[model samples]
Target: MGEVDPAFVQELEHRPKQGIIEAEGLPIIDLSILSSSDATPDHSQALEGLVKQVGNACRDWGFFQVINHRVSMEKREKIFNASGKFFAQPLEEKNKIRRDEKRVLGYYDAEHTKNVRDCVKKLT
Candidate 1:
């Protein structure tokens, strides 16, 4: 909404225009075959298909949703609950894991996208 940072502008200069190229929908990848124990020819074909789908998704969209992943629903729910608990913690507690400016790891409250920046190095 304000003047975009020159560095950010430079970063976007070579990227494709937003919304210029659209895939039919968000890419979805199934991982069931890769996890199967059977090594039949059909399973091999499925695995090959899986690899191609993953590669195309990475090339076209950079990321995609996965189905039939190994993690159980219970573990997924636990992860969600833990995320909620951490996000709900007091500011002082959350700051302990503040991600520094240069690193992409740890936690933060705000995100920057397009040309907007929000500060969130600490919970407050």
Candidate 2:
């Protein structure tokens, strides 16, 4: 988008870009093992490994993708469709629920990130 704000450009110039070079990719954690309730010894060990994977993913990346989470594709699609509709609204309409000092659980138009990019996100 047009040139980034000069202030943001300056900030980016001073920060290290090491994280990008160090990152492999977003971590992917399987939820299938955690969902089982089997009492076998192997199951317990597997569960522990799963937990460790989750902890590492959180501590290092702050987030991770989960597979075999058991949610139906239809339900996921519904959520995606709804989100699409919500974000597609005009800025004026979205601003009706804009987050402010008094509330921290609504739409945020421009969230600043360490990389000098603006991210639009909603919190609920």
Model 2 lDDT tens row, 1-124 = 6875664563656554677527767789998986788999999999889999999988766678899999998998899889889989999999999999998889986776565555435443
Judging by lDDT against the true structure, name the best candidate.
2
Give the lDDT of residue 36 in candidate 2: 80
Name model 2 segments beyond 4 Å from true: 1-26, 39-48, 118-124
lDDT of each: 0.75, 0.79
Flag clash pairs in model 1. none
Q: What TM-score would you give candidate 1 relative to the actual structure?
A: 0.54
Name model 1 segments beyond 4 Å from true.
1-23, 37-49, 101-104, 116-124
For residues 5-124, write the lDDT of model 1, one tens digit per residue. 564443556565667446357789988776679888988888889999999988876678899899998998898779788988998998888899776698776665455454223222
Which candidate ranks first by TM-score, i.e. highest? 2
Error of 1 at 103 (Å): 7.5
